[model samples]
Target: MPRSATDLLDLSELPAPQRREVRDFVQFLLTRQAGAKKPAASYRFSDLCGTMAWKGDAVAAQRSLRDEW
Candidate 1:
């Protein structure tokens, strides 16, 4: 889940053992459903759509989406 490579990314910067606490809270946020909230797949599709238009082709973009299943 780390988007970067650095020791400064860990919870050592906190005052106590709150890493697990923070992780749980973030996981809850990711899985939460409110109103028109959608899963991670929706965003992936948006990403694919964006690239497809940029590259002038949508064939590989669609295949990338199917691979998620």
Candidate 2:
């Protein structure tokens, strides 16, 4: 019953090709773990401030809408 990675694997005893395969697998797992820990990009309302094209006067539109209510 191996309690740790070092006890579980004796890299020096493995054949060269098998050792390379193990190393590649370890690198893949490490890369995947690092990618998982990264935070997703954050968004802000300010980023969308000028994205839309307004066709009419905003204040006048609001007033008209209010009058209709």
lDDT of 2 by residue, 1-69 (tens): 646433457899889999889878877887898898999878887678856778999999999999998
Clashing residue pairs in all predictions, respectively, total 0, 0
Report how far residue 62 has shifted in candidate 1, in Å. 58
Q: Number of the top candidate by lDDT?
A: 2
Q: Candidate 2: deviation at residue 54, Å?
A: 18
| True lDDT of residue 40, candidate 2 | 85
Give the top-scoring candidate (TM-score): 2
Give the alpha carbon lDDT tens digit for every residue of 1-69 in model 1.
656223335777666658767766666665563433844544466655655336545888789899999
Ten-residue stretch with the least lDDT total in model 2: 1-10
Task: Estimate TM-scores for all models.
Answer: 0.31, 0.44
Superposed by TM-score, candidate 2 places the C-alpha of residue 5 at a distance from the truth, in angstroms, of 7.8
